[model samples]
Target: MPRPYLLFTQHGWADTNQSMMALATALTAKDEAQIMAPCLDYAMTWLRIAPLIDQVETLATATLAQQPELPLRIVGHSMGGLIWLEVLNRHPDWWDRVDFLVLVASPVGGADLGRILDPLKVGLGVAADLGKDRRPLAGRIAAAINTLTIAGDIDGGSDGTITVESTRVPNAQFVYLPGLSHAAMRCHPQVIEHIQDFWAGKRLSEPLIPHPLVNRLRQIPGMTDAHLRDFARSTPWHTFTDGTSIHLWRSPFGIDHVFLASAQGDCLYAGYVGWLHGEDLRRSLDALRGEPELLEKPIL
Candidate 1:
């Protein structure tokens, strides 16, 4: 007989476990999987995330101790996904047992809004923790586990809260639901259907093909991907030979936001860097100036 599934569903910031539990129930209606949905304090979510992580870790460890042979399936929404990433990073031994992992509307790439709230990174409540980028850790975990990232694109780029670009992770299958909001993702029918399909050996979405300009921008340290909705406000900075254009927008806080637009004026990529990475971004762009194929005419 096949081993029973030990399913875990986690809710995000300012959310109760009710929606996640409902989702867990819907997912396991046929398989009778064991579900673990912890009710984290809603008020406490405004604080640091470490304590919340500790609570879930302790519960999961105890449950696993009792059922050592059960296979694992995890579903985390928003901050819940971030918490699971940290937990898995702390326990590599749990990797082999994770049959599947699903992150719904989770910002794996540091949240831009979070950084905007706490621009100085001074641990101002939960902003500092939420602003942290966990892609490297997520990439390592994805390399070892069957991972799926589901994002909501209500505004062509964001889920009304987290940017679609911020939900991306390396080596993971990605699914984006149109007109879905961040809060709606926790129990959205389409989101549930996609998850069910993914588990049944169906490919619901394709992996994004890497773009050369985007790849180079990703290499620059401390860069956080932003939403494309703000691209209209940015001024054109440079235009490349391939019709790719770069735009710049400085935030009121003096942070530099960059946008890469395609030949047809589509926002291909958008990212921002804090004061610390200002020089790095400048030097990287200057280096791109020397590449003839990349730069044809300067619009600055």
Candidate 2:
């Protein structure tokens, strides 16, 4: 069983519950923990920022009211942590209520690229306004909880998007994985130990695994070497002609949610999809590239 914590999982960009389910299974091995992963879209998507902020506040308030006895702990992956930070910024009082906050391969400050492209998104109207204001959001959240942050040095200082400098908060405990990629560090056994130790309020003695490439993957948009390491555990081939098949394996490439459309073709959608087929679609997305692969998989 996992520890008796709220176990709120914040996934990366475009991710739904697909990635969270795998994490919940691993973290709750002891069975003592109950995890709740909500359906969250990209923070920049889904209308304006106020509504998005309200979404988390509403959920957190409900969770706090219902599970008063259970220690509330939050774990966010990538942009998911960014959303969590947004929530905390709105309601700082909730920070004291939380036990521990564990951010896996999360870009706390801001993704280096985010700084560059964010303007384009806002300018071209591709995404909602996500400015430097989000950077301070994480710092505010850290003030509320016993925050623990993990960053990968594989790509300078990014899990892939947010830079390490972006993730730095004034008082939060920080750990830098010199060689692990942003996403790969999520599956590293050392990451598990750090998460568990923080939950138990213990300090980590040594990293479980300190493989390099953590920061190296920052060079690419969706190619995290950490995915290469973690990929073997689920499926060797991620790109598949069939979207459903791709979801069977954990996706190494970054997407919001993994999904396979009902369309009849030798292709699997790579981007975002609902539950069930999330893992199934990621299994077959090994061949395609960029956003096109996100929604439609090509036949091999």
Candidate 3:
């Protein structure tokens, strides 16, 4: 019998190996495949594209060294996606080693949040690394391999931290999860199923899966229902599209309550909407990205 392919799962910035381990574990349950979850150097200080490219190539080379004969498959979340792109670019020969690639909530078009807070040691090459207009590696990534781009949209169309726009690229199959967040895209069962089917050569259907809201607002760590009431009729509201920005001011009590919506008036995400820690909170938000002074934050 032919050997099963090698599946490598890479975690996003400030994320642990376990971030991709859940999906890895699920893929290996039947003992028909093997998944390798590698933890990258997710430091805020080392976000420059060149240095990061070197780091990823090293990891990929070593992994391939172990079982060079097996065909390769990859799943990268957020920064992990970019890392793999660079790996393929730096070592063109590695492309021969890869069979399929999946990018989940990766800012291949550039991270809007990175552009906003680049001063706080978030220097992932903000100059050329954070916008859709300057996707130099798109051609490299779009070549030869069938790349799958999956995103979560809880706010009009965002995964709380990444906009669906930020995660897309030309010549790639895009799957959007209307009810999932950037982080949740990593572990959501629907997301796992998507990866599983795509890896096994199954045809991805049209009108991708839809995730439903589950009163997840009150699930935020430091928020309560009282905080959500701040969005009542008289309250000021703001709106934006994917890869855009929205500023919310604290209501004197040192807290900002936010809600996310689509242009046609549809809700996306709900939770404790606070600043400094991250995006997504007691309110709904869409077209949002990133965290402030937060090494690690949750997506809406």
Candidate 4:
């Protein structure tokens, strides 16, 4: 007989554990699973995230101690996903026990709105913590665990809050559900369906193969992904040989924002760099100009 599931469902900032609790029940209705859905203090969520992570870790550790052999299946929404990433990062020993991980509308690339609220990186309530980019840590965890990321795109690129781009990470399966808002994602039926598919070892969609230009842009120092809500204001600059293109937009404060678009006019990436990495961004763009394969090509 297969080992029973050791399941965990975590709620995000300013959220009660009720939604996740319902999610947990739905996910394991037919299976023999032990579920742990901790109700974090809603008021405390407005502060830092470290204390919250510690709280969850303590509960998880004690639960594992009792049944150390059961394979783990975790589901996290928004901040909940970030917490699990931190927990998994601190305990590599627990990596093997994690069978599956699902991040529902989590911002793995950092929350763009959070950066706006705390531009100076000050500990402005929970903004600074929410704005942190945890992709590197997520990448480390994904290498060892079977990971799936579910993002809702109510607009062209965002789920009314989290951008689809921000939810992406390397080496993980991605499911993009159009027309779904952020709050609706918590216990959406489609979200549940996709998670069930993932648990059954099914591919929800084709693996995302990022454009080569995206890979190059990511290597630039201090480059951070941004939301596409402001993409309409940007001006087209250059189009590459592969029909990929670049657009430019400068904030009133002189901050540079860059965007990547496909030949089909679909937005592929939106990112920005602060003054510290301005020079790096320029040099990277200049280098791209010299490469014929990535050079400007007129849109026909």
Candidate 5:
């Protein structure tokens, strides 16, 4: 029997294979293909895209060698998208290997926020890559293969991290989603649907979720913070994503209160910052049904 299509997913800055796994789980549900996700390190004092791309190139080359006849589909987010642009540009032969490509809120233009820290040189590598006028391979990418660009927008503007303008690529089809953020784009149900549809040859149009519910998604940064929670809504509510939701809030008085709740409002990861809560936190996470990494990881 022929092998299933090989789906590869690359994650953005500071994120891990965990986030991409959720999408992979959904995409491979029909036994259509096996998915692999590679992670990049954007930790403090160390950040560079070249090495990251190199790793992907190596992976792609090796994967294709093992299964030369299998169809390939790639999905990249933020920096991950930038990495693939270079991968295909550098390895022109991979063109035939790829059956479909998807870029989710990737910042084809470049992320302006990176400039805010340019002086520190801490994240300049990524900042320059995300700039709108900074991407050189963008046009080449669109020319070689049909690519879909997905941009997320919260109510105010931008996907909380990436601006719609930054996500745009010349000569490429663009889909703008309301009530979605950069992080949310990686795991949002609607976002996933659009990507799956695109893979199935559907034009990227139609908004997945309503504007009102979009406002309440936990994809927004600081959604769990005391200040942001109080500001965003008057009534207490859980985030839109499934699994156990945990938010560590620090009071003005310096007391840290950890709030944990299920998608149905059941407490899952709650604790006081004082002591002996690590084990309790881990125990709670053990019962999580969907994407626990979304709850455990710090939301930047």
Candidate 6:
């Protein structure tokens, strides 16, 4: 059977496939829906120019071409979400194909971090193209699609990396969660519930009951606080790849990106950030032909 919804994760520079796959694992349980998180190529960051949109459209077309019946829904974390928006802006026809767009901690407005660094130096060239006066991809897509931007309030105001205001687009619905870090929103079950409820026809404005574990994770030491700090310090860089690199991030069940990597590894990681069950992480690592260190250490 074809997938009805595509859930994707667009990792910032510091993330990896392992982290996103771990998120996909946590979102699943005994009777949960099936989800796949494909890692995207690094070029998405720099390919922010016009061609990047074409890259995402091609991916959506390919996913649906394999199974034409499946509807498309795009979910991108960080810049990947913006990539999805860029795809839709160029291909308005795909608007009907997309059921929902969930962006996790993405800077729909120009990111403050990007602004802080001179636009010329940011390797992805996104800063260069997405100039102060230039309209953002998020702003462009918000006018065309059913969009939702979710920001984490772990740092009181901002989601560690993106500010609350930056995640806002003109017409799209916006959500702000307290305590959840920018990266942790992926693993937060409440986020999954929000997505599922939206899939079940809930309005974008519907209120959701908070997850119980949301509070407990903060009480535990060395975990929540550590990630919070990491989220703040996390930055993006370039990734070096030869030839045409097709990075298919699995946020929307169908949409993705294709890019040409520069000599420098100047791209973002296609990963997810969330609180995952240790057992699930173990299983996912096994599935990915990798081993997780969490499984080896004794839980004190």
* Steric overlap count per candidate: 0, 53, 16, 0, 6, 20
Stretch of 10 with least lDDT, candidate 1: 291-300
Per-prediction TM-score, please?
A: 0.87, 0.58, 0.62, 0.88, 0.63, 0.56
lDDT of 2: 0.54
Error of 3 at 296 (Å): 47
Model 6 TM = 0.56
lDDT of model 2 at residue 166?
Answer: 49
Best by TM-score: 4
RMSD per model, one decimal: 4.1, 16.3, 11.8, 4.1, 15.9, 20.8
Candidate 2 residues 179-243, lDDT tens each? 77766664577777678777777764332211111121121232211222222234323333433
* Candidate 1 Cα RMSD after full superposition onto the native fold (Å): 4.1
| Candidate 5, pairs of clashing residues | 109-130, 109-131, 109-132, 110-130, 110-131, 111-130
Cα lDDT tens digits for candidate 4, 1-300? 346979999999899999999999998988899999999999999999999999999999999999977989999999999999999888899999999999999998888788778778879998888888898688778878999999998777789887788899777889989999988999989999999989988987655556668767766776777777667778888888778888889899988888898999877888988877798999988888677855344311
| Native-to-model Cα distance after best TM-score fit, residue 21 in candidate 3, in Å | 1.6
* Model 6 regions more than 4 Å off: 1-9, 22-36, 42-55, 119-140, 204-300
Better of 4 and 6 by TM-score: 4
1-300 in candidate 6: lDDT tens per residue? 234455444444334556656655654433233354555555664545455556556766676677565566667777666666666766787677676777777766556556444334454456644323212455456666677777787665577876654565555676778888777875677777776565566676633221212212212221111122222223322121232121222224321222222234332112221233334433432432232333233332
lDDT of 5 by residue, 162-232 (tens): 66656656456678788887888887788788777877778775322212222222222212112122222
Error of 5 at 270 (Å): 43
TM-score of candidate 5 on Cα atoms, chains taken together: 0.63
Ordering by lDDT: 1, 4, 5, 3, 2, 6
Which 10 consecutive residues of model 5 have the lowest summed lDDT?
218-227
